[model samples]
Target chain A: MREKQIDKLKDYKYGFTTDIENIRAPKGLNKEVIEFISKAKKEPKWMLDWRMKAFERLKNLKEPNWQKPKYPKIDYQDIYYYSAPKSASDKPKSIDELDPKLLETYKKLGIPLQEQQRLNGIAVDAVFDSVSVATTFKDKLNEVGVIFCSISEAIQKHPELVKKYLGSVIPLTDHYFATLNSAVFTDGSFVYIPPGVRCPMELSTYFRINASQTGQFERTLIIADKGSYVSYLEGCTAPMRDENQLHAANVELVALDDAEIKYSTVQNWYPGDENGKGGIYNFVTKRGLCKGINSKISWTQVETGSAITWKYPSCILQGDNSIGEFYSIAITNNHQKADTGTKMIHLGKNTKSKIISKGISAGFSDMTYRGLVDISSKAKNSTNYTQCDSLLMGNKCGAHTVPYIKNKNPESNIAHEATTSKISEEQLHYCQQRGLNPEEAVGLIVNGFCKEVLQQLPMEFAVEAQKLVGISLEGSVG
Target chain B: MLKIKNLKADIDSKSILNNFNLEIKPGEVHAIMGPNGSGKSTLSNILSGKKGYNVSGEVLFENKNLFELETEERAHKGIFLAFQYPLEIPGVNTNIFLKTSLNAIRKANGEKELDAIEFLKLVKLKAKNLKFDEEKLNRQLNVGFSGGEKKKNEILQMSILNPKLSILDETDSGLDIDALKTVADGVNSLRKKDNSFLIITHYQRLLDYIKPDYVHVLMNGKIIKSGGPELALELENKGYENFN
Candidate 1:
């Protein structure tokens, strides 16, 4: 029994793929493919035109080469741009009408769509393949003036809000992968918290990629209106495959005057096998704009999966007295590579930003914490504090911290601190002597090292993230 | 409870112990006094199942072969080693570590694990009995602790786990007189007919308080002299060089 438990911890538990049939768009990335996606979603002309604009801009942009880890060149034309469950062709009007197979898939992933089995205090939008399958507790949210639904539903039902804020935070011409996401993105969750109201429950989206030879492009946009507050979380998982998959997502957030938006992500996508055979290339763009006075936006992410992860969830402080905070814990193991951190851009007077990042690399993986903190000259009295820490396991893995700080304001203060540490054998031996197994010892130590960042997560996500922090490094200890 | 016959150990082909023999019965506190490089620490490390050593011996604990067990497995079977230099694991709370360790041992022995309240109560009582500051339990394990405080923490852990066989490897080296008394008092309180201790030290000062059942003078990886509590006094007076 103990051996089986250890074996369970050694392998990725979410590697099983559902054998459901899929309705796939023609494999390729051309104007016709983009048109097919837009038309299939029954999007309005303006949204289609926006996608075409992004597609045209994508032609001039190139896949970024600045990241530390490089993979084989992706044949964009070979990947199926859209793949959804066959039963989800015409979206279900209610959770009861949803296909049992899709519901079973999410249920097996520990997310029960059945009302009675649903996790209390959380409203979840489960996205499979390329589209959201079901969103629970919709009626309760609608009563509170909360707009929570799939992005596709939002584009049709709330076009004015969608058109106004779709690309407000991350423009279509942001970067290559982000632009790619903007062009071919199929569906994701959309949230809007009306002014002067505190969201009654946590809003979450779980993304699962089940189809083969497909690219999952999801777009999530959240807006917290004046005096409103919301906490949003995201989680992702993909089936184990012998071929690499692409998951480029764009997440944007906007906070109006006195509004607060807290975003957390526990990304546990398949990180390939121990030999680095295949995995997802998680290139994502997540940014928030504190556009109104006294607004605040914070991003907390625990990234433990993905073969090649390259993203920096950033914040742009454009309103006076606005605050931006980023707390992240990124772990890479078993031939995985990640270069993740946060970017804090201070553009308004008296704006404040704080960043705390913890990166742990094990096995033959490489991890980097690359962050940027820029305080503009016009932002008088703005203060930014950053703490970046890295932990490496064994001599085979590598950890690096590259921080870019631009302080043009003499009146502003920017404090940047970084540390690089390795778990010592003596510490492991001591823990083992105290009766903890090698795996538990490493987990406890790593969790302790990431206590500050973990504290930023919500109660439920914090517990899950803590376990992932341990499981991600399983077998790294000899 | 522990029997070792003709045990030999080598690290990187450098011999550390050869022809070493000892038997510790239940409830016996045996002190092995030796100078530097006399294999006192090697014996503890080998007995506690530390890797990187080429060991060949017959070591039985409660009639079970000790060599086949992992470090934690040995700990599960009731062996506890209070490290000479207790490691400072930054960020691991002392109280949490103690609870985890205690629960792990309990779970391994098929005993019901203690909940937080019960564990905290046990820790509180044990800390008080050892005269240890309870507030420090909330801080990172061994981090920023003085030498004496670290030693006391190891003793506190020993008392909490309540292992059947306890090995103190030079635990009294950096302790002051008052701390030495507290540590000795902790060990004395834990003394029972079913609990045993192996105290490895260079000085006879600790034995003066704990009162070991037997004292052995070790030199050059072997026991050269063995006697009652008077053996420790004789060795301390003559010193290792002349006694050998």
Candidate 2:
């Protein structure tokens, strides 16, 4: 009788899609396809050359396969490298010129880009498939000297700004997936908060992958000049009809002197079916460089999607007294596998960093937290503190924590702590005795478990992330 | 307010409660004194709708079959089980937990939800009346609390929820004399014509304060003897072996 409650929780609400005509590259990857993508974007010669170098380097590079929870083998030549809606090329100046079908899809997701017509406090740049179809609140952001647009548009209009910082933080020869991403990334958001300017509203990009046969390679770059501050949010959702897709993204952030950048993401892509037939393979590499004194960068993420996830949003504290913070909550269920954490590399004097991670695994899924805090000899008097906690909801799930703390400086102070626990029957009974239903009790307890990381998210995103945590773990227990 | 007939419970094919029977009426406080593993805790667990146990019996609470309800449904029906070891849930504020619980019970009873201000007023008055520190209300539920404090929190919940039938399991096991008296006083203050309590303890120490009207001795999963309040003192002076 009680199993019916779990049956009702199996439905994924974000699986609906709209049928629209799409323009896609052929199902293969080669030098000619690379040329096709570059010519399609109408990029300058230098950008095309850069992509070619990355692709050439990718031929010799190998995918890192040493993670504790391994990912499936990916076929390199079987994916469509570039895809975009046929109407995406028009680049509508306003919402009226956009396709009604595309606008209706965004409306159903509560994106507010077409519904309110930019009447909200947040500006959204919506990316469909391989291109940015609609952007709102451009004029208002322009009034305050904030540049919020797609990466491709930034490369076209502000070439110098894009060229100066594109590969500065994450170079072309980074990891295998990042190198592949640099070669074929079609569209992602870009933001540049000018010097001494505090962004008026939070800049957000809503990414939706519609085409079934394409691989999504999104590249994002945000630069906060001296004494500027900006907060950016990114969200992604995919339809249920998945045939083992791949999403490889590269994000780079630069915070100059006295600047701060707060980046938060709530990613809910389509997980495979109950038996794990087909889902998205998400491999992302994100890094931020604190280049000037007293600069700060913080990354908060709530990951409850993707059948197999491997990413580590790292921070490089290269300036004196700079700070870095990472708060993450990764949940995997029903044959999912996630190997995610963060890296804090202290290179300057007295650089500080804190890492707090929470992982919940259920239903035969394996979750691993692999993190590193490296303190160089030159980073004298540096301080690093890390706390990683894991919770298991069922007997079949697995949770593992591997923390590496390398303190090379004699004057540095570093502390690492970890704990693994299961959701106890006592806690649930206590909640149920107070009149909370089973799922509500689970929600309450899971929220309490993830409170440390959830508080770091923005107010609106926090509420949404809290609900998503409960929904992601539903029916995975017992 | 509650009746049980032919209650049999087992775990892992081991019998715990076999043909156990009890009846509790409104406004009466009954005490069941038993030795270790005499099926005291199992009875409470079964009554509160805890899963993973083989139970066969008829349990009627207010003219309804108790076994037909879920744990939360049983709670909404005014049946509260104050656990022997109150679970500590860190990161969940005590005040918010109480408020959510109160509103849930109220909603189930067809009452309107209480806003923050009304909830604060009601909670403050109850906390003060129970001599509970107000600062604990903002902290996580029973986290880092002393043993006596945890028991007091349970009583505080019982007092505020005002359940029609309260089954407290070993509430006096770890309390000192003063704390024990406070717990008993909290229970006594909530007694009314429409409310009832079933106090289960290993000793008769707690019954001295709440003054249960009936005392029963359970052995080997069944009630071996039953009598009035005087039976408690008899067991207290001579120990449970005296009945044998």
Candidate 3:
């Protein structure tokens, strides 16, 4: 019985930590800490001034408490704002020069940074703790006038592009957590697809939070020039810990005329133990701007981790004839709490948006689908469709759908549909009578419930998301 | 082969079955006819290993205790139950569900699982034999299906799995005359000297097509009378109320 209990919790496959040395800045959230992070990265004076501005604004900003999932008060002064592997301080010039320990860590996470073992046709930028250790396929990307590298390198190499689109979508003082990320943000991916160039390969970034007591705040920015398209995938995981850690990330996307951006994320952070003793407090802000005519942006995310998750990846449809879509599947189990969805704002004529969100709650967990669809008066003939579905496994858990819809234009149309259902005993017994085990039965039914959203993910990610969906509800069945 | 000795079942302290005894050998088709609330469904439920019943007494399948197994384990051991009320599971493709169920049983029996190509071919052949719509296989399982279509789908599944002991629990409940013949044809095609069937129903209409080797009359959870095919026609003429 004891062994079985341990085996049940072992469903989190990526809950192992690496024993690597790290260079740490002073703990706490202060000016010196922000300066230490900027100076440590050798950023320019303008970047330091920007960090200071965010810090000054952060002094008066209070943490938002209106979210459904409440957590203990986080002491900003006691948390380490910056922590990096000691070998990554000087920045390795190539994969060969990087520390083997970092490479091994990625390998264990099923993301190989080595060229020979690299995944086919997928460029990767690996971030360990507070710094990006290695980026693969740089020379090939550079061949097509595509810039795919770490944000730190972009600040020094393509400063003009970074400066133009860094805060263009998500401003510095957007919210408390976003503002904190802007102040002491560490390393994340930066991609720039030039005009008329469809990216040759899928661009991906794998994030690993390995250090203890350190909060991970990474900033990612993607810009697709006119008539260009890119599909970017982001995946993150963390080691199991007894203390709650913070992961506050800001992702911004900009698409030019006739350009499109597809962003997919598979967040498998280590949810706290069965008792919810410790886990990651994931509060992320992700948004995209369709700035040019006929531009499009779509966000697909599968969130099955974290103790308390609060995020809403949104879109600003500023271009005429632009399209925005948000497809999400969020599953919470074993005392986890998640309140996630999307926001679609139509500001241009003939803009269109679709939101499909699926939320599944099991065990003692709580899940909510909170979204907004706003069609402005100036956006004539715009249309929006939203569907929210929630599946509850047992009475101990809760699933809520909270949608805010607004249509100011007489010509515009907005339609919203919401539903709440439970997996019936008859369904389970039927599947079992047909020879499926209990866990497999639940997986099939839940996957069917989330089929509309799961179909939106990329092929490679769809398979993994399906398996994660099954593994997340391992112990929920009686 | 299956053997039951003094099997008793109760749900919520209400007696469902008491002193139930029967035996089925290979190559024999037996039909149990009973009126409503006569414990016909409870007997089938116990043999298929469904929960929520306080069961006593021993049930053996080929010398293995059936009560010690789970519902899925009993399915793996070659017990199939066609439910009276087939459930409609939304978003699960009928083809995919069949493939998963077939492969699970095959793997449990120490046999090599069938690949997609081989499995699809098998399903196609069986569906064609049953005259089931080819397009419906690609749809969500049982969702929006007519009563006749749902019953035919169950027969299609039964033919594909090819279990040793098949129990039809009110399989003729909602089927039409044409669908009933099709279901009987599907069952008759799968019948072999090594396969047995236990058909549980109210009327003897289905027994006319399949021709069970023996027929038993159940009342108040016990077999009050036992006879051959002639007994069914007699019951049909006399009605269950006056048969005993």
> lDDT of model 2 at residue B107?
96
Candidates sorted on TM-score, descending? 3, 1, 2
Per-residue C-alpha lDDT of model 2 across residues A10-65, encoded as one tens digit per residue: 77777877798887777787778888888778888888888999999999999888
lDDT of each: 0.93, 0.89, 0.92
lDDT of 1 by residue, B1-244 (tens): 9999999989999988888999999999999999999999999999988878898879999999998787899999999999999999888899999999999999999999999999999999999999999999999999999999999999999999999999999999999999999999999999999999999999999998999999988888888888899999988899888885
Give the DockQ-based CAPRI class for model 1.
medium
Interface RMSD, model 2, angstroms: 1.7
| Model 3 chain A poorest 10 in a row by lDDT | A1-10
Candidate 3 residue-wise lDDT, A1-478, digit = tens? 0122324564578899999999999999888999899998999998999989999998899999888998888988889989999999999888988899988999999999998999889999999889999999989999999999999989988999999998889999899999999999999999999999999989999989999999999899999999999999999999999999999999999999999999999999999999998889999999999999999999999999889889999999999999999999999998999999999999999999999998999989999899999999999999999999889998999998889888899999999998999999888888988889878899999988888878887787788889899899887876
Q: What is the lDDT of residue A18 in candidate 3?
A: 94
Model 2 chain A: lowest-lDDT 10 consecutive positions: A1-10
TM-scores for the candidates: 0.97, 0.95, 0.98
Candidate 1 residue-wise lDDT, A244-267, digit = tens: 999999999999999999999999
In order, the first chain's TM-score in every candidate is 0.98, 0.97, 0.98
True contacts kept of each: 0.72, 0.70, 0.67
Instruction: Give the better candidate number (1 or 3) by lDDT.
Output: 1
Best prediction by DockQ: 2
- Ordered from best to worst lDDT, the candidate numbers read 1, 3, 2
Candidates, DockQ: 0.58, 0.64, 0.59
